[model samples]
Structure formats: C-alpha cells, structure tokens
Target: MQFDAILKQKDEIIQQLQSQINPLKNLVEQLLAEVKLLREQNAALLELIKEKDKRIQKLELVEHQYHQLTKLVYGRSSEKTSTALPGQLSLGIDAELVEACNINDGQKIESYTKIKSEKKKHPGRNEIPAHLERKYIDIHPENLPADARTLRYNRNRTIGI
Candidate 1:
C-alpha cells in the first residue's frame, strides 16, 4: 500500500509538468516569430536609406549642370555691350521755372529710396504697379521739367576745376 501511494504521487507530478511545458514552448515560438518580423523591417529601412542617398546624388548632379549652363550663357565680365545706342529725348529748358521752384527742407529722399529697395528685395504677395516700376527712372532730375532746367543751367555754368 505504501509503494502504490508513492507511485501515484510521482505520476501526478509528471502530468502537471507536461501541461506547463507546452505553453512555455508556445511562448518561445511566438518570440522567435516576432524577431524574424523585426529583422525584415530593419532590412526594408536600410533599403529605403540607400534609395534616398541615390536621389540626393541625382539632385546634386542636376544643380551642378544648371550652374554650368548659367555660366556658359552669361559671360564672366560685368560690363554689358549693345550694338545700337540707346534712344535719347531732347527737351527745351526754361530758366524761369528753376528761378520760381522752391526746395523742400524736410524731404526724406534717402530713406524713401532705401525703403523702396528693401521692398524690391522682399516684395509683397501682390503684384507691383507700373508706376512703382517706373519710379527709379522717374525720380531722376532729367525726368522732371523744372529740375531738368535747373540742373542743365548749373551743369553748363560750372567750369572745370
């Protein structure tokens, strides 16, 4: 009777161990499958990095070609040459207009010019008007009727020092 009881206890313990072993094996298999999936993702990421490198190289080559073309088309010299002379307009000057004109003491001409230049460098979203486009040439003394007469008289009166 004592030998039979000992044999029964040993058999019950073996059965319990077998039941736990199967679940542990299943957990190890799941972990192995996850590791394989992670390896595949790492391989795909490496491939993507290589493709991005190739694209960057191609863009750099394109930029180099564009610079070469620009240099070839535009000469290195700063001076611009034209075959024909620019058209000139002759206006009769009146000395009386210069005698009557009054000069402004508070004119901020320099600041106005700087502001306009800055605007050109960083233009607004709206398109520029034709009047503003012509402002640079328009402000010249030669373009103003009264100022042109005064400048012409002064230019002719001044002797070479």
Candidate 2:
C-alpha cells in the first residue's frame, strides 16, 4: 500500500510538471517566432540602408558634376599659360589693331562668279525646302586684355527657321 501511494504521488507530480512544461514550451515557441521575425526585419532594414547609401553616393557625384559644370560655364573661360621661359619669343599679336583694319577699304574689287549647277531630282519623297535665315553669333574668349589679340577666330554658321 505504501508503494502504491508513492507511485500515485510520483505520477501526480509528473502530471503537474508536464502541465508547467506545456506552457513553457509554448512560450519558447512564441519567443523563437519573434526572434525569427526580428532577424528578417533587421535584414530588410540593412538592405534599405545600403540602398540609401548608394543613392546618397550617386547624388554626391551628380552634385560634384554640377559644380564642375557651373565652374566651366561661369568661371574663367581662358586657358592658363605658364610663365615664358628664357629665350622664348612671345607669339601674341595686338588684336585691337587687327579689328581696326577694314577689309573693304572703300575700294571696288573685281569679282569672279561661278555658274550655278543643275538641280537633280531626289528619288525619295519630294521634300520642300524651308528657306531658313542664317544666324551669326560671335563668341569671344574671356579674360583677354584690350590690347591682347586672339590667335585665331572661329566662324560658325547656323540656320534658323
């Protein structure tokens, strides 16, 4: 009878322990799920941070390029030259004198005219020609002294509609 009672008490104790263990097991499972979710969120946040960093780097690069472009447009337009070495002759010319000279000189010169070529019909669709006026714009270099002369002047022609 004592053995039977001991067995019964031991069985009751085991049942109580199992009941406590069931709740603890469930709690452990819940904690594990929370930890997994937190890990995933951390990974996603890290990826987002990395992408933001890349975007920031790109924006910085673009800003740097914009500053360089601004400098090119509004800054000095002349090329920098080193100091002339000994025995080197200066090739700069007086541009003001060149500009003062008149090419026409109020004199009539003989003109030689060329014969006009015959117009050839194109094989494609007849496209009417839009006779647009020509526009001329003179661009001068910056930072040149009034007495200084440019080595060469460029002539550009653009047609306007």
Candidate 3:
C-alpha cells in the first residue's frame, strides 16, 4: 500500500512539470515569429537606403556636368583673336555687324606715320686711376756689343732700386 501511495505522488509531480513546460513552449514560438518579421522589415529598409544613395549619385553627376558646360561656354580662351587695328574701335567679328557697316568710297580716311632715327653712342677706353702712377725703368746692358747677349737681373735688386 505505501508503494502505491509513492507512485501516485510521483505521477502528480510529472503532471505539474508538463503543465509549466507547455506555456514556455508557446512563448518560444511567438518570439521566433517576431524575430522573422523584424528581419524582413530590416531587409526592406536596406534596399530603400540603397536606392536613395543611387539617386543622390546620379544627381551629383548631372550637377558636375552642368558646371563643366557653363565653364566651357563662358570661359576666356586663346582661340578668340581681336581684328581691330590701332585708332579703330575694337569690334569683334560678328556677322550681323560686319554686314551692316560698309566702307564708303568718298569718306576721307587719313593716317600719318613718323620716321625714327637711331643714334649710335660709342663707349671710349677707360682712363688710368689717379692714385696709380707709371714708373719707366731704363734697362742698359753692361755687355752691349755681343751678337746675342742675355741679361739676368735679380728681382730683389730691381725692386729695392
């Protein structure tokens, strides 16, 4: 009879544990479904962000091309040459203006030119300095009548004299 009572208490403990396990299992399934929905929403937001970035890049490229075209149309370049001479107005070569104004044959157009003469100036030789004076030394040979006579004078003796 005690063995039978012990078996009945064990059966009650197992039933309580199974009742708690059923509620925990339901909570786990609900959490898993919520996680799946959030992942789908995150992927859609990432795709939207990528599309916006592509549109911003395209607009920036178009803006850069517009600025380049504006600079090309308005910037100064060496290709444009002036056609007006001196004493005449600096009018650019516009087809409409050139066609409207024609040179009259009876109009008196007078121009004068002056001749220029260049004078050449020669720089003369430099003069000697006032502080420096010239000293003339008379070198008379002692043996004057030899066919080819050579003289060896000491520099110290000449400088002292």
Specify the highest-lDDT model's number.
Answer: 2
Off by over 4 Å in 1: 1-13, 75-161
Residues 57-138, candidate 3, lDDT per residue (tens digit)?
Answer: 6677789767766666665553223323478875455544544577773478698899888877787888988899766575
Clash pairs for candidate 2: none
Pitting candidate 1 against candidate 3, the one with the higher TM-score is 3
Worst 10 residues of 3 by lDDT: 76-85
TM-score against native, each model: 0.39, 0.43, 0.41
- Residue-level lDDT of model 1, residues 97-150, one tens digit each, is 543456764466554444443345655498666676332222334355653433
Task: Please give the distance, in angstroms, between residue 136's alpha carbon in candidate 2 and its true position after superposition.
Answer: 69
Question: Model 2, residue 146: displacement in angstroms?
Answer: 51
Stretches of candidate 3 above 4 Å error?
A: 1-9, 78-161
RMSD of 2: 30.7
Q: How many clashing pairs per prediction, in order?
A: 0, 0, 0
The residue-by-residue lDDT of candidate 2 on 18-75, one tens digit each, is 8899899999999999999999999999999988976786677789778776776677
